[model samples]
Target chain A: MAELTYREALRRALDEELERDDRVFLMGEEIGRFEGSYKVTAGLWAKYGPKRVRETPISEEGFVGAGIGAAMLGLRPVVEIMTINFILVAQDMVVNHAAKIRYMFGGKVGVPMVIRTPGGAGAQLTAQHSQSLEVWFAHVPGLKVVAPSNPADAYGLLKSAIRDDDPVLFVENLVLYNVTGSVPEPEEDFTLPLGRAHVAREGTDLTIVAHSYTVRRALAVADRLAQSGFEAEVVDLRTLRPLDVDTVVESVRKTNRVLIAEEGWATYGVGAELAARIGRACFDDLDAPPERVAGAEVPMPYAKPLELAALALEDKVEAAARSLLAECGLVGSA
Target chain B: MARAVDEVHDVLQDGEQALRLLRLMLLIRRFEERAEEQYTRARIGGYLHLAIGEEAANVGSIDCLGPDDYLFTSYRDHAAALAVGSSPAAVMAELFGKVTGVARGYGGSMHLLDVDRRFLGGWGIVGGHLPIAVGAALALDYRDVAGAVLCQFGDGATNIGAFHEALNLAAVWSLPIVFQVINNLYGMGTSVEQSSAEPELYKRACAYRMHGERVDGNDLLAVREAAGRLLTRAREESRPALLETTTYRFRGHSVADAGKAYRTAEELASWRERDPIARYAGLLREHDLLDDGQLESMRKEVADEVSEAIREAAAAPAPDLGGLYENVYGDERWREQFERMDTAAPFGERMETRSWQS
Candidate 1:
């Protein structure tokens, strides 16, 4: 096993998939010669040449739609949208065309394409550049949405997404790119399955549910709570669309209390959906109502302190966990 | 199997292939006339956009496509579907929303697709499918596949951002695709001139550094020749181009409209006088390729076929409600995994068969 940065792991997945399948090609703005805006696709252009690692203009709608069309014709086109903010321009293509093509055509063809974009808010990159929009894609039925919490999942999930027969929205977080985690050796062909969640930490006192970057914050928050004698479990929801509710419900039953944490807005967000589902699935097992810790309702501000305050950081998650425990009388008084 | 209808006979000195093309056009015209009647009788529901007077543009352009090449069109797709050799009965059943329809009742009048025939789709969204067509071209190029894409759209689609994006990408990538703008004068009620700054839509290709041309869409032979040339160049050289087929729509945007507010009777009459079928039949008569008897027999055959399609479509059964949620995702495993999330409240139950086999 070797520790690799999330960015390196992603690049390795792309390199391996490109080498493994001639049909798998990259298409996006700044993905080839520009080495990607986040440098996640660094050196791919030199390695695979322009055809496999194709560079596109700032035309998200055009290129994204093209990726769907290419996929329909039996090419696996992994398209990068620079960031989730730019994905809006191509929303019609993704939802209307790619997602609906399979069903509307009565299963004649499938869009075996992947739309990879990063959506998180740690950097002080104003309102537009920094916003978590994975929930938007998750709300869409035809799309498979996955957000990996670490490098290993990042590598495995991306490879699986490329090989998937249906359209997938691979959501990446800008802030999680440099985080390090141990990945399996190249000789060991590793791929995580979609529509499944993993329990990152095992505990019985409380279940802290999260996905993507929030999983890291939840683990850290769990560690802080453990210091004060609260053994909180963490459930990493790897796939958001075909959500692994069974896993979340299992953790809730074990803990009898839950706190949902997310890096997006709480209202009508991933947390809202999870909370409602948990309320039904873990109705009798719950010691208290499921609580949620999420990013501030306002659009992300540019100021560093304001940005940090707006984020769903470890402190906010810890606070939400502490309140859930207090409400259940598992710790101190509310 | 034949690349173009013209190539079927190097010495159509006899005009057998020409007569076949005429028969196909006649079938579409009669099919559309019956479809209008069906709509009036409340057999077909939803928005019905017909390609009534655009038969020459539809049939002529499609006659140029090789079997391997792909075709995509906008919602005015009954003629396009017929020209592409889709089952007339199946297409009519689709308009009737029956289970035996081309799309199995999933896609009504607008979203027709036949993957077996390489007709990619009958997209309801105008200009949205342009980039998709370019992507198909990209796929063919990547795989070294021996085929190209033919994307047909209306005049108003030329003014959209996707039109520019799709053409520009096709040019930059050197993808093999021939974009056909069947400029039937108006998109819904907006005329091409009032809607597009560059009403001469083929010239819009100059912005992308691609070849562009316009043809008299009412001239069947002219349309076929121009389309065949552009498509051949696309397949052989990976050169994308724009072919503007200037025609007119005899009906309104949809079946609901009377098609009179924006157009005058005089304009309509003048265009009708230059009817493509009549014009082609006149040419055939002049060359002694077809006689009055042959023409009358062909019309009678097409009318009979149209009547049979309507009869079959009306008799076709409705789609099975048990399979309502099929194909929402390509994988059935997704349904099994997500079934737990289906709430039990009113209107919250997922529309999936508990056991489709039973």
Candidate 2:
């Protein structure tokens, strides 16, 4: 087994893929000499040279669209946006061209490109930088959206995202870079399938479904509940687009109670979609109505406490889980 | 590289090439005329943008492109497609949204494409495709591919942010591409003078320190000359350039636009006087390259071909409805992934409905 930080996992995936395939290259602002805004692409730029580790100007629409065009011409381009919030500038290209090219062209060509971007609010980066827009890309049909919570999944899913034939939005968490976990050994042939959910902690009392950073919060809440003789199941939804509803329904069937945690607004969010599907599939099995724990519905403020309250934190996940368990009449005895 | 003025003289001396340019321009004119008629007859739906008066700008620049070059354009693309050798019948069939059309009728008038020919697409967004076109040029540079890209758009696209970004990147990267602006006087209804602070669009290329020039788009031989030279420079030296072809649309922006609201009849008549087709014909006659009989025969041949295109397009069948789910995803695994979302009952209710059974 090999241990790696979330940021290291992402870097390893990029390094391995660039070495494995010559067609794979990178394009983004400050990604080469600047070593990325997040420093995830630190040494790879020095190793790959200018052609492979291509640097771009602060023109999101220009560079993102260029990536799509290169992909159409049979090259695998991994485009990195500084953050998901800045991706709005290139939304027209991402939504209209990258996602719709293959379908609009009647399947004549596919845009095999990966857009690696990070989202989530915790770093007091103000309203503009602090935002979660995974649902925006996941809402689209042609793009595949994947957000891995752990270091291992981050490494495996990114490798798969680069190899995927269609355009993939590889969403990452801004705060999970320092977190570490054991990845498979380099000698072991390991690659996680997209659209699959992982059961991080198995329990019988309740099911807490989440994705990205929220999964880590939910797992911690599960561990806390276990101390009080309450068993809580945590399902980390690794992929959002080709959502694994079957695995979620199976978890809901066993637990008979459901709670969804998301870092975005509650209305029309990824949690909303998951709750809708779980409500429909496990209606007869659910001991109580599906519940959600999400961030405050306003634009993230700059204040430290306000930002903390506005973000999806561990305390929020615990309260939501406890309330759902109480409603299902399975209150744990401390 | 061939100088712009020298190529004009060369085109004049070569009677065979001059006649071919005249024939293609006539074919595009005839095709657009028939396409407008079909739109009125309800054979074609969606927006129908015509390039009736801008024949030289469309035909001349595209004439310089070789089999190795890639071409991209804005929505007013029927003329460019025809100039690039897509059959008139297939183009018309696409407008009809028939199964046999290019893009399989999926992309109608605004989104025509022929990937095999390297005419990437006719993008619908105003300035949306410029950066994408730049990226294609970057790919060519990266692979050291011996080719260049021609990105054609209307004057309206110049005001957009993507346009500026694309030019800046193309200059910085030294991508092998030419950004051809077909200044048709009006971006839909707003004139260039009213819209741009510096209405001389070619001069804007100087901001990126790239080569830029303006040619009288109505002059067929001149447009062909400048475009050929610039394209050669791009492929040989990997230098990006901007070529502005100042032309005009004879009709309104689309078929629905009357085109009379903003401009007077006198202005319309003035542009018509400089009709690219008639002007080219006059020049060809002056050079003893074309006679009245030959011009008449050319017109008759174009009219016949356009008529046959309409007939074939109208007869072609529509794409099957069962394939509604097709082309959405390239990977075969998507089928199994989407299968779980499928339920015979509405609202995800798997229970069998007894009302129909009863």
Candidate 3:
């Protein structure tokens, strides 16, 4: 294993996949010469040349549909939308065509396309660019949504998504790119199965469920709670659509109290979906109602303090976890 | 993989090929009539858009395509499927929502595809398929292959954002594709003149500096000529072109529309006078290629074929309900992937549930 940043891990995965498969190619705006807005595709265009690492005009709907078409015709296309917000312009292509093509066409053709885009806040990108809209695609049946919270998962999950036969939405986080961790070496071909939740930390008293960048926040909260003598189990949901509720329920049943967290709004968000499912599954084992902490339900502000307030950070999560533990009569040291 | 492609000039001179073209158009006409009857009889359901009055526009351009060429069309796709060599029984069975249909009853009348024939889809959305067709051309260019893509849509699709994006990409990249707009006068209920600032749709290609032209859609040879020319250039030179086939639909956009609300009877009568099949048959007769009683026999033959197709479709069984989740995802592990997602009994719901809340 070698240490790499989350951005480096993703770039390494793309490089390896490009070398591994001739059908795999990249398409997106500013991905080629400009190297990408966030620089995730830096050096890829020069390495792969213009054909394999194509740069498109600011035509999300065009290129995304083009990616679908290419995937339909047996080529693997990895389209990069500069950010999750830009994907809105191509929402119809994803929701209607990419997601529905296989079933709608009666299994005649499948789109093996991967749409990669970064989502998250904290650099003052404001409301539009800072949204976590992965749940919107997750709510659809055909799509497979994967969000990696660290460098290792960023490496493994992207490799799996590139090779998967269906349309996989690979969600990256802008803030996590510079974060470094150990990832498998190039010759290992290390890959992770999608739709499985990883229990990042094992604890007994409370369960905190989260995904993507929120998982990092949850883990930090778990660490803070450990200092207070409350061991909170952190269940990082790697895949959102084919959600590994079995793992979450397993954790919830053991802990008896659960808190779901996200960077997106709580209403109809990933947290809401998990809360409903957990309520039904762990109804017998519950110590308290499933609680949730989400980003403030407002357009993210430009001011630093307001942005910090808008996000569901570790402090808020720790407070919510402590409150749930207190209700369970398991209060710990301050 | 390079093979000789026939131009419209050569095919137009061949009498036997001309007769086959006439027959294909007749077959589509007969198939649609039965489909309309089937819809009213409650045998077929959903939005059924027929190419009844625009047969030449559908068959003539599609006939220009080689076997290796890919096809993508909007909702008005019955004739496209038939013209692409999909069997009458299979097409009819699809209309009947039977298991044996081209798309196995899943893609009703609006969505039909014969993938082996390289016909990608008969998509239901208006402007959605254009970019997909352009992508197919991008694939061909990427693979450095010999085939091209032909995307057919209505006059309505020209106004959508995807239309502009698709054309711009095809032109910018010099992808091999022919975008055919079968302008049947009205986009459902509205006229092109009322909807578009520039009523002449072909000129829209100028925005991308792409080659564009218009043809008399009711004239069979005219459509064949333009499609043939553009498709050849697409295949040989890797160029993109827009061909507008100006025609009229005798029936409404869908069977639900009475068609009388939007247009005048005088206009309909005038178009009926220039009916493609009748026009072609007269032309063939004048050239001494068609003889007395030949047209009647061809009509009789096609009518019988369509009737047989209808019977076969009617007798065919509907798809099994148990197989509803078959094609949603293509991964081999999709069953396992979705098994966990089965929300009915999330882990402990069925395991001796703790009262109603469980």
Candidate 4:
């Protein structure tokens, strides 16, 4: 295994895919020359040159539609939306065109494309920029939505998403970019499948299921639980659309309690979906009523303290997990 | 379909070409007449847009497109699909929502596609297909191929954001595409004069500094010549252009609309005098290229063809109900992704089904 940051892992995935297949190309605003607003595409423009690593004008609807068009004509385009907020402008192309093309076209051809964008809050970027809109895409049919927590998953899932036969929305977390982890060494052709949940931590006292940046927070919360002699198994929901209920349910069955966490608002959020699914899967027979820890339901505030409070912080996750264990009458017993 | 203009020069200059063009237009007119009847009979469902009076605009532009060209059109695409050589029976089957239809009854009248002919789609949204057409051009350019894309939409699509975005991208990238606007005056209920600030659709190309032209859509040779030349320029110069074909639709926005709501009887009568099919037939007659007997026989032939299409489509079975969940995902991994939705036994045993079925 080799150590790499989440950003580096994503970059390597792009570089490898572009080098491996000529049909694979990148298109987005400032992706070339400027190297992307987040610098995720740094050095790709120089490495692949202009045609493959294209720099698009700030026309998300145009370029995203272009990506869909190109994918229709047998080219695999990995389009960057800069951030999730910008994708709303191109919602028609993504939801109506991209998501509906495969089914509406009667299975004749499908878009083998990937739309990679980051979504997260905490930088005090305020309401518009800080929102997590992954659930909006996940709710759609005919589209694959994946959000990897670590560098290994970032590398593996991005590669798999690019190579997939349908349109895949590869969501990244803004805060998870600099987080480092050891991805398997190259040349092994190591790649993870989409829609498989990974057990980031194996424990039995309680199960904390989360994804993207929330996975990191859940892990930190699990560590805090360990200090209290409790073990919280953390299930990283790598793929939201094809959520791995098998893994989540199996973990919950062992722990008898679950606490779902997310960086988005609790209502109609990932936490909400998972909690509902878990309750349905287990028939609401859990130790507690499947608790949840989510970011504040209001629009994210710009102030630092307000931003921290609005986020699903580690303490908030720990508190939720502790309450669930306490309700199960196992808090002090642990 | 990618043959050079000179390759078709002899045909266009002779009576054989006149017969070919007239036959296709008559076929479109006949097919649409049958489709309207089918809609009335309740055989066809969903939105049904027809291109009756704009036959010349559809056929002329579509005929110029060779094998190396890709085609996209607005929902008023029955004529466009027929012009691209999609089997009349298959087009009718698609309209009839039969399993044998072009899109297998999934995408009925508004979303016909002939992947083999490279007729990408008949998009339901007014301006949505423009960017997709531009992207197809971008694909051709990326492949360094000698091909171009022909995107057709009505005057109503001009005001949408996607239209401007598509045009700007095509111009900035110098991609190979021809944006043809069939200016039939109205975008549903709203007229072009009501919707666009600049009613001159072709002049909007000047904003991108691209070549723009307008042609008499009712005149077969005018549209054919303009589209053919522009498509050739795109393939050779790696440039994009805008061509506006002025025509009028006899039907309303869809078959549901009577078209009398916004148009005057006098205006309709005036446009009927300039009907594309009639104008072409008159021109052919003036040149002694088409006689009344030939026109009658051609009409009879087209009528039989469309009648056969209708017979087959009506007889064809509806798509299987089991196929409802198919094609939403084009991958083996969909089973894993979809297992969570299955409440029974959770993820007992999953199986991967078809992938795009292509």
Q: A1-334, model 3: which lDDT tens digit per residue? A: 9999999999999999999999999999999999998898899999999999999999999999999999999999999999998999999999999999999889999999999999988889898879988999999989999999999999999999999999999999999999999999999889988888899999999999999898899999999998999888999899997788889998999999999999888999988888888888789999999999999999999999999999998889888898898898888987
Candidate 3 deviant stretches above 4 angstroms:
B1-7, B343-358
**Model 1 lDDT per residue over A19-86, tens place:** 99999999999998889999989999999999999999889999999999999999999999999999
Cα displacement (angstroms), candidate 3, residue A132, comes to 0.7
For model 1 the TM-score comes to: 0.96
For candidate 4, what is the lDDT?
0.90
Among all windows of 10 consecutive residues in model 1 chain A, the one with the lowest summed lDDT is A325-334
Residues A258-331 of candidate 2: C-alpha lDDT, one tens digit per residue: 89999989899877887777777777998889999999998999999999988879898899888988887877
Number of the top-ranking candidate, with lDDT as the measure: 3
Task: lDDT for model 2, please.
Answer: 0.89
Least accurate 10 contiguous residues by lDDT in model 4 chain A: A325-334
Error of 2 at B158 (Å): 0.5
**Candidate 1 vs candidate 2: which has greater DockQ?**
1
Tens-place lDDT digits, model 3, residues B243-333 = 9999999999899998999999999999999899999888889887887588889999999999999999999999986667689899998
- Model 4: which residue pairs collide? B1-B66, B1-B67, B2-B66, B2-B67
**RMSD in order of candidates:** 2.3, 2.6, 2.7, 2.8
Give the per-residue lDDT digits (tens) of candidate 4, residues B43-73. 9999898898999999988998877789999
